[model samples]
Structures are given as structure tokens and as C-alpha cells.
Target: MNKNKNQYINREISWLSFNERVLQETADVNVPLIERMRFLGIFSNNLDEFFKVRYATVKRIVDAGKTGKSVLGGEKAKDILEEITTIVIKQQSKSLEILGAIEKELETENIFIIDENEVTDTQAVFLKSYFMQKVSPGLLTIILNDLREFPLLKDTAAYLAVKMVLINEVDGNENKENKYALIEIPKDIDRFVVLPNEGDKNYIILLDDLIRYSLRHIFTMFTFESISAHMIKITRDAELDMDNDLSKSFIEKISSSVEHRKISDPVRFVYDKNIADDTLSFLMDKMGIEETDSKIPGGKYHNRRDYMKFPSLGRKDLMYSKIDPLPVKDFSFEGSILEQIAQKDYLQYTPYHSFSYITKFLREAALDPQVRTIKLTVYRLASNSQVASSLINAAKNGKQVTVQIELQARFDEQANIEYAEQMQAEGVKLIFGVPGLKVHSKICVIEREENDKIKRYGFISTGNFNESTAKIYTDYTLFTAYSPLLKELNKVFDFFETTYKINKYKHLVVSPHYTKNVFIGLIDQEIKNAREGKDAFIKIKMNSFTSYKMVDKLYEASNAGVKIQLIVRGICCLVPGVKGMSENIEAISVVDKFLEHTRVFIFGNNGNSKVYISSADWMTRNLDFRVEVGCPIYDEDIKQELVDTFEISWNDNVKARMFSEQQDNAYRKNDKPKLRSQFAVYEYYQKKLNA
Candidate 1:
């Protein structure tokens, strides 16, 4: 199957297809009812990103004609744009069908999503009270007829496009023209307006319903014969451009870019186009949204991501019960984490195990009198980050804290900038990233003065050190005080200070130079073993596997009879399980309660196995452009744990989707016992803790 004439599927188009798989989750009847609703939230969130980034890029391409092809990865910008619109239209239709199915299922459970018209007398009174007390204060209604200048609509916020027919004559049949107005749904208020329950039946009203109920009050001055409203939302370009002005601080440049993002041109204009032409035209004309923008026909409600926080209504049956994170077996809270690392390396499996170990280690470092210096890289951090707090504490206690915080972590520019400022004010030395490269590596090194020598203790991770995200994002954190590894890591920090001076690494695989070659060499080793008739295999679990070079290499290894298994959670361009080409290759994607965010690679070299946990996926950008780190799991126990996790995921028959070129998103089938990897992973860690 030569898909090469297609060269490569447009990244944006492929991303939309990936989202279609998510939408499939909502449509799948096998999925639990409440979980299906949450899938809707995931779908909405995905579309918001599609518009902000992918669609925005396409829009830029369409505007810039010929030059757009290079940016779009071999596809013409216009061709990609047309393809995305067609695909999105189909996906939207599918979404509606999914919603209809979900609504029907909700009815079976006695959970009715009541609209404004369906509300009874008692419910209306409660809803009215809710409107007054909760939503009214935050509502911004723009009188379209009166305003001199059009209001600048905030991207991602839903607005009600209102049409009112003024009662001009006594006769009800008199020809009266309609007036248009706009009301932005207050994002601060809960989108779900829970109504009083009637015995066993649960009732809920959407925030849109409340707004629909209170529409007359919003426009009391203008008399109308008839009124109608529909939800509309616009998504704008989110790409930030860095200024080359050396005088301005990095934080200032990011802040300015964020401000610029607010007024960025609309990429997609999604509306309940059941709206009258006059109303649509009035809003479109005022918003300056032209035909070039992708105008999508959508349902009455937009921004369904609000449903992610959908109130459980104390219904325990409707929600997944919280799983308590188990403690890591080898690493304990009693003694110094550094001391344990000093003896041998340890692995931390987050979400399955408490992420507090990372925090505790840093806190220990901050308090340890012998510790003189600490260095780390920050990409995306939590709002109230314990990592930042710990680093600041270290700086306060006379420890030299060096942080290379990336100011351009997408959607997190403002947060990282704020963090950089806070860390700088606390006397923590800040490196505003290498001139052009984004520091995507997650590494921390603490230098402790012990026995007349400085010994380094730190952890390298495949995920960020954000505690809040650690609860839901499955990631690996490798803790080690191995002198060789630490020395190489210290060199990585030094490279950030001195970008022109590139250093060779012996242990750790540093990206932008060594990562690609190192990975290729390892894969070649497996291939060589397969050629020699030795037991050879490769297992990788990553967020995405889109690099063509890596794909081709894997394909070659597969043809050579090397067993290849991949558990990619998102974006897999390489189709697995073809007859001759990839008969030895198998790929599955697991999407469950926790996001499978960890990147693990296992290579079988003869009888010995080498496992690695990396911050980078097998993506070209990660390998060639970004500063990523892939560290070997030298600790035997940790390597075994990673192997076990990969196996558990590989064995997953439930919640694992088979990835094919067909894009069916079919569930992996097996006669074996049901295995959901996320659940199995948790159980495995729990058992480890108990043992």
C-alpha cells in the first residue's frame, strides 16, 4: 500500500482523524453512559485546539499562498484546508449522532436533560433564581443595534446570536423586521444548571437553557413580537511569535505575544446556523468573520468542554471512583531520597504511585546543609506547583537554583512567564532557554557537598514535575545518583548556558544531536540480533509515532522477523499488521481514566533487554529540533516495572483501540481475560507496594 503519493497525511488532517477516534468513544455503546459524556468533553477540547493551532496554521497558509506548502509538510495549504473542512463536517455530523444516542441512553437512566421549553413551573422558578443569583452578574449582552463599534469577541467563549421581531402593528400578521443582539455566556458560571430532583428521576438544565429562559429580561427596552437565540463560538490562531529585540525580557515578549493572541484572526466560526440569515449576517459582519473562515453548522450548544467538570450530583454510580495513588516499594518517605539514590537508581511510576516522592526529594535537597546547588528545566508547570515551591525553598536556603524555564510552552506561555518572574524574584538563576531551541527535557540535579566531594542526586522524567497533572497523566520519573548519568546531565545544563559548545554524551541520549543516531543504533542492534536468529523484539509506548524515518526503520525490522509492539496513545501514522510489510508489528492505543503520557522503549539485544524512558516521542520535531532527553533505566527493579507496565498495556483487550490505515478505531479483540492497562497498572503498583 503506497501512501507515498499522498507523501504524508497533513498533520492537521491526521490530528482531526485522531479526534474522530475520540468521538467514536462517545458513540460506542460499550462505553459506560457517564463516561460517554466525558468523551464529549474530550472531543470538544480537542476541537478547540484544532481551531487554535491546526486550523489557524491552515488559515495562515491559505493567506500566504505558495509559501504554505513547506510549512504544511508536503501538502498544499489549500488542499489541506479543503480536506480539513470536509473531514470536520463529517465529524460534526457524527458528533450529533453520538449526542442523540447519549441523550437516549440518559433517558433510560431517568436522567433527563431538560430544555427551557420543557421546564415545569417549579423548575422554572428554581432556574430563574439560578439565573439571577449565578449567571446574570457575569453575562455581557451587546446591543447590536446600538453599539458604535463591534465588540471584540473572546475566542472559545460561546455567545447567543439573538433575533427579535419588534411588534410594530396591532395586527399579528403585520410585516415586522427582526433585530439582532448578542449575549456571551459567562464562562465563570457552571455550564450545567442542576435542577431540583423529582424523586427517583434526576433533572439537569444547561446554562444555555437558563439564558434562553431569561432572554426577555436581557432586552426589555426593545419590544419584540418573537424571539430566538442560538449559540455561536469563534476560535482564533494561538501561535505566538517571539520578538528578536534583545532589550526586552523573554517574559515581556511572551506576555506581548499572549496579548496579540487575543486579537488574532478567527480561524473557525462555528454556529447554530439554524439561525436566521439576518441574525447570522449581523453577528458575522460585526465580528468581521468572512467566508474564508471555516463556518461550521453546529448544535445549540458550543464549548461542551465545560462538561468535563459535569457535576456528579452525588451519584456515585455515574462517576469513576477516585483511585488512591500507591507508594513506590523501594522508595520510602522515612529516609532521605538522596541517600537511597546514592546507593542505586529508583523509578517512580506516577498516578499509580504517589508523585510526592519527587517533591519530598527536592524538599530534602533544600533542607540538606551539604547541598550547594540545584538545576532543573521547566516546561509546563501547575498553577500552584509544588515543584516551583520546592525550588524556591532551595534558593532561599542558600542553595544555587538554576532553572531553564521555556517561555513558549503553548497555551502555557503566560503561566511559565509568571513562574519565571517568581523564580527570578526569589534569587533563583533563570535561563530563558537557548536562543532558538525549546528546552523540552525534564531533568533535575542537586549537587551535595559530601565527604570532600560534590555528589549529584536527581531524577529524569518523561513528564513534567507538575503534581496536579501527575494525578491524571501517567508518566515515569527515574531517580538516580549514578555519577556518569549525573555528569552527562550537568553537561546538558552547561550546554544551555553555552549553546554553541555541543558535547557528546556517553549514557543519556540528548536530542538535537545524539538522540536520533542513538535510537537508530539501538534499533539496528535489534535488527542485527534478528538477522542472527536470536530472540529479538522492540516494544515502545509513546504519545505519538509520526516520524517517517523511524517508521521505515521499524518496518525494515518487522520484515526481518523482529517482533514489534507499540502502544501509542495518540497520532500513529505508521499502520501496523499488514501481511508482508508489517506482519510482525502490532500497535494498540489505550485511552482510559488516566492519559497514557509516558514514553517507554524496550529493545531486546540478544537475551539482555535495554529499556528507556524519554521526554521525546519518535517525532521528527522531538528528535531533530527540540532539546529532549531519553535516559536508560539502569536500575533492575525499575526496568522490570517499566517492562511489566508495557506488557500490561500490550495485553490490554479492553479500552485499547487497534490502529489501522482504515481509521476504523476498532477495539482490540482477544479470547484472553479482560485487561484494561490503566487499571492493571494501578493494581500492579498496589501489589508492589503491598509486597
Candidate 2:
């Protein structure tokens, strides 16, 4: 590795380190027992996707016989694959240990997760009946011993690989045969099978165990001497390969790509290492997998992602209490949202604040008699999205409604395609996307008849408008009536419709056109201020930072004696605290109860600061390749709130880890009292509601 290589951490490795911080949360004793278990689920879920997308990409590069060192940030694709396997093994072992600790704690709380071996008579009866009623119908089983072809395994679904030691009786009239089979756990059913409580003791069994209990019934005809079962999982490449055929519609292209992804070549295979050697060999041979494939040896259970749906079982103390989403204090729907927007800008912080205000704004425009046109861009939406419904309703009423739906939003293609078709059917003008750019900007604009002239009002956000996700994913939506900015926003929509022309943005920072220049100009401002002996500093919080141009710009600012603080949640490439290099820059990553997702960029422009919440990060994909927006926080109160939130996150002692080249994930050490930022953020919003 060279100096520049040492200056930056590998993006994929940095991402795994970020997930390791999540795993740390599960092992953290301070967290509530059940919540820690949920953290394990989160860690597992994060790992699954990392393999599906990131790891799978590396494997492809390796398969194509490319070293891929430059793209992988100084690590060869093959080397990164081996590193991922090793790190994942360590993390998996840690997770098992954490699960054991959590189970011990649960027992202390009179809640037990019993397995097949530990199931009581009553629990067994309950599981048997449940299996017959619910699980049996959905169970897809195959006799592996006799089949000419091994069954294709679905990615993300866990399966039980059974090895049946059938006793072949030499009966003169009976034909005997050995048997082995596989039973896939149904994704439609709940993973946690809760049983009838016995006096204060609440018992839970995994769906896996319940299946184990019903194995005899599944293979009754075969007289098995003994049976052993273990779990196995696989993750495949998720990159969609779109056909360049002009005859195919965008929706058809997306449909075909989504279908193709299901059968994409496997990137990672995880199985119980304790599995019988014969059984393991049989599986490897049937699946046509070679020893060169990433065959990871794991423990008995896989697909811990199912724990995301772990039942509450009315155990109120075991889970975090639901924090009711607060209303945007001054913004209301009784009157025209446009009128309120015409006066000043507003910020809507989600989960801690209601997302309904966004829907309500669109709904009002859709129903209002005075509204003329509505235009917006959608990256992702809830399953039964009211946002899409309102747009459809607007179209039905003969109002102009335009939606630029991003069909390339990773893993959400089918949903976006479905919404696109539904909106098109309702007469809404649908923009597939900019020819080469994914429209990731969360923006909405409404034009209405007021004062005998057309007026504009709307908002921009740093995340998707999906209502279900809004409750968990922290994001910021800015509602504004600034005409200059609104006019530029309108121009952005026009640019989407006419991709051949690019419009100049004066106020709003738009990507693939102006974002990089604007950001670099802002950094130069800080560098100039530092040279002038003025107060110069920059504070930024984003999900990921991987753009080499931006990183070099930050380095220039740092070398010019400007202070930089970063609170990144994932994939940070910039190294801090290096002598004469990034000594002025301090970077920390905060991983806690709530996902630190909202992207906030605060530039110390000689103390006359400019703050922006953007849907785009500093990554190359977000800057030059996607249609993303970064809206300035014009509301004084909202700007101060953003500053305070950033400060609080920077002050996090608990759940905050230093981003360093060592990848140690060391918790930020401080003499100050413990402050978990997410909990504090919730209280901060709560106090605002009380005030």
C-alpha cells in the first residue's frame, strides 16, 4: 500500500467496520436485554445486504480476472473477499456470544427462548398444532437423496439441511432406501413462535425449532435411525443489468432485471461448519460450487434477519416504548400550507415529528380547487403509499401531476415500477428518470392560483418519503416558499422532463450539474477564511463520504489550518488526526438506537454559516450520477435546531466510535458525563413539544 492508500480506508472494509459498531451495540450491557437482541438482528440484516451488494460486486470483479485494487481503495478484489470472510466469521462468533448473554438476561426477566430440545410438553403441543395449521401448507420440502438436481435456494431465506440416517431393514417384502431432505422456513410466517405463558414466564420458540418438531411428520414413510439438521444461507449479486434494447419499455426493462436478480450467481455461501462432511460435500457438488467460492463456516442458525420481526409478546419492558411522532408545531393543515410556506421556511424532522404533514401538503394541493400543478420526484415509497395515492387523485381531478420515479433505487425497483404503472394509469405524467441519472432528490412543488397570479410552495428532504420508514429512519424535510429557490426547484423538474437541456441553479445546490462545484467553492471559502486569520471551521454529518475529489478538497482545507469535524454513519474514506495531513480534522461515527441517517452540512463561512440538509452525500454516485437536491435551512429556529443536533451528536460519548485507520472502532473516550445522542435527540424533540 502507498501513502494515499494509507491515507484512506477501504470503502468496503470501512462499511464492515460500521456494521461492527452495530454488533457492538448488541454486546453492550447497558442496552436493555431485548433491545440488544434486536441489535443483533440489525447487525445480521446489515451483513446480509453487505454481502448481497458490496461483497458480491467484489466477487464479480475477481471472477472477471480484474485486480480491482483502484476501485476497491487499494485492496485487491480477491484479498477483500478473504478479509470480508474473516471479519464476518469474527462478527458471527461475537453475535453468538452476545445472543447467549441476552438469553441469560431474558431468563432473569422470566422470558425464555426455548429450542426443540428444551420445549415443554405443552409448548410442543402448541407448536405441533401451529405447524399443521400454518407452516405445513407453506413448507417446500425436497428429498435430496434421490433428486437428480439440487433445489435452487432463495437468497435471504434460511433452510434446514437434513441428514437422515435411515436404517435399511432387509425385509423380504419391503423395499428399503436411505433418505435425506431439506425444508425451507417459510418467509410468510413469523420467526418467533410464542407459546402460552405459564405464570409470569413467557416462552418463545424459533420457527426453526417448530419445524424440527414436525420433521417426523414431514418424513414419516422413511424409517430414519437418526436425523441432524442445520441452517444454511446464500447471498447473490444484486446489480441489475438493464438491456439497451430501445424496443423495451422502461417498466419492462426493470421487470426483467428484477427477475434476473433472483437467479444471479451466488456471491457468498454460509453453512454450519459442524455439518457432516458427507452432507457438506453432497451440497457443494450438487450446487456446482467449487472450493474457490466463498464458503463460510457458520454456526447452526442463519438468516437472523428474521429477528427484525421478533414478536413483542406484550412484554412492554423488554422493548423500547413507542415514541408518538410529534406534530410540526407551527405548521398545520386547517389553512393553506401554501400560505404558511409563502411567509417562511419550515423543517419537518421525522419519527420525532410527524411525516403526515408532508402527505397532508400534497393531499391539500390535490383536492384544492385553486391548485394548478403539482410536480415531485420519488426515490422510494411505502407499500400502500398515500403520497402516490394523492398524486393519482390529483391527476384524476384534471390537475397536472408529474412524478419522476427512480426505477434504479436499489432493491426497490419492483415497487417503483408498480407505482409508476399505477400513476401512469391514473393519467399522471411519469418521468422514467433522467437518461443517465437516477432521480434521488426528495422534492415536491405545488403551484396554485392566489392574488390572481400563480404562486409556488413545497419542500425538499434528505431521505425517502416512505411513511413506514419515516418512523425509524431519521431524516429532515424542509418546507419553503422562497421564490428564488422554488423557481430553481421548478427548473429542476423541467430539467427532468427535458434531459437534453441543463438549467443553471442560483440558490439550490443540484447534483450532476452544480453540487460538486458549489461544495468545493464552499471549502475554498473556509480555506480563504483560515488564511485571513478569521474563525474558520466546518462541521458535516452524512451517511457516507467516498468521493475522492471532495476528500482532497477537505485535505486542502485541513492543510490550510481549518478545523473539520465529521459525524459519518458509514463508509468514510477520509482519515483524520494524521500529523501534518489531517491533523485539523476530527472524525467520529455515531451508531446508536436510531440510525444516524440525516445528512447535514454546516460550513463556517467566516462565522456567517450556511447549513444544508441534502438527499445527496459526498459519494460519487450521489454527486455526479444521481438527481439529488440539497436545500438550505432558511428558517432560523430550524437552522439552530440543526446546529444543536449536530453538536449533540458530536458530544456523544456512548455509542460514538472514532474513525481511524486501525479499524479498532474505539469508543470515543471523554471525561464528560455519558450522553447517548439518540436518546437525547428524542428528549430534545419531546421538550420542544412540551414547550
Clashes of 2: 0
lDDT of each: 0.85, 0.87
Q: lDDT at 146 for candidate 2?
A: 71
Counting only residues 3 or more apart in sequence or on different chains, how many pairs clash (N, Cα, C under 3 Å) in candidate 1?
A: 1
Kindly report which residue stretches of model 2 are placed more than 4 angstroms away from their true locations once superposed. Answer: 1-5, 170-178, 689-691
Model 1's alpha-carbon lDDT is 0.85
Give the Cα error of residue 341 in candidate 1, in Å.
Answer: 1.9
Off by over 4 Å in 1: 1-9, 28-31, 67-74, 146-148, 169-175
| Highest lDDT scorer | 2
lDDT of 2 by residue, 1-691 (tens): 1145477788888999999999898888787677888888899999988988999889889999999988877778999899888888888888888888888988999989988899778777888889899999879998887788778888868889998887764655544444668889898888888899999998998988888878889888878778888888888888998999899998899999999998889888899989989888888888888898888888777898777777777777777778888777777767877778777777888878899889888888999999999999999999999999999999999899988899989989989998898899999998889888888999998898988998889889998989989988899999987888889999999998888898988788999889999999989999999999998999999999998778878888898999999999998999988876788999999987678779999998887899989999999999999888998877779899999989988999988999886889999988999998888887888788779
Every candidate's CA RMSD: 2.3, 1.9
